[model samples]
Target: MTTIVHNWSMIASGLLTTLVISVTAYAGALVLGSLLAVCRVSPLPPLRLLAATWVTVATNVPVLCSMILLGLGIPRLGVHITLLWAAVVAVVFSGSGYVCEAVRSGINTVSKGQVEAARALGMPFGLIVRAVVLPQALAQAIQPLVNILIACLIGSSLAAAIGVPELTNVTRALNNQSGEAVLMFLLSGLVYLAIAYLATRVGSLLERRLTRSQGAAR
Candidate 1:
């Protein structure tokens, strides 16, 4: 208790850092993942193959391994990547794969008849996707996307291994200094639980609003 009180500022800073990284990484993942999802469903065989390969490799590789490669290996090759950006890139890379899968699944759920009708009307592929497919798919993808956001938040803690000083890293340092490992970890866990709960609630609210809007549109 005393330890946490004394280190409140540090803990708050670390929490803020964690949020920044998670949100940034999740945003990047959404953009990259959406592109990947499009490619995965592209008419071009090569594009589909490339996107599939990326999803396979990125999903299979551990986030820590990616981090180490970006943070340590790249620097040895004479290219500079700060630990912060390395962490962000690594999370974005891995998270993008999951996001791609979620979006692809949502895309799959879109009615094939609608697509066929759009094609029959001579709509270009891009216009059909943008005007007829993506909006509906994205609505269905909300929960999965939210889950990815939460995963990004948890995964941000791994950045501590590369010395990013996120919440878990700060907690670890405090534990080492105060020797109150139980209390320190417990406090951090509670914070995480709270944040995750809020994320879930927000997802639910958004899902309900979309559902109501869709129902009314029908």
Candidate 2:
């Protein structure tokens, strides 16, 4: 306990790093994935192909391999990025594939009639998607999207491999210094649990609010 109490700042910083990575990565995944999902359902064949190829390749690549490639491979090209951003890019690229799938599935749930009505009213494709498709699709995909975000949070631990000093990495360091492996790991696990619990609560609140808005509209 003295070790934990004394080294609390290190542990807290590690947890903060994990959280920052998770948030930034998840936001990037959502934006990129939404665009990819739109392209997947686009009228243009080339756009569809481009988006589909990205999803296929990103999903197939191992997360660690992606991180390694981004971390090491890009440096050889004379473009330098930090180990942390490399991890963020890898996570966004990988997680976007799953996020795209979830969002596309949600888009499918939307009524064809509504889209047709929007088209009949002379709404452009972009406007139709923005006004009619995305809102409903987002509501439908909320749960799955939350799951992906949670997975991203857990996956962010992989950043430790590249020396990110995130929760897992710092916990390993703490364990080495304190020689209390079990205690260090237990504390790390609790931090992860707290993050996950907070995420679930936020997700539930969002879900309830969306439900209420939908009910009010009807």
How well is each residue in 1-218 modelled by candidate 2, as lDDT tens digits? 89889998988898899988899999999999999999999999999999999999988998889888888889999999999999899999999999999999999999999999999999999999999998899899988999889989998999999889999999999889989999999988888888888888998999999999989999
Once model 2 is optimally superposed onto the true structure by TM-score, how far is the C-alpha of residue 98 displaced, in angstroms? 1.0
C-alpha lDDT (0 to 100) for residue 100 of candidate 2: 94
Off by more than 4 A, model 1: none
Predict model 1's lDDT versus the native: 0.94
Q: Compare the candidates by lDDT and give the number of the best one.
A: 1
Error in Å for residue 139 of model 1: 0.7
How do the residues 67-105 of candidate 1 rate in per-residue lDDT, one tens digit apiece? 899998999999999988898999999999999999999
Candidate 1's TM-score: 0.97
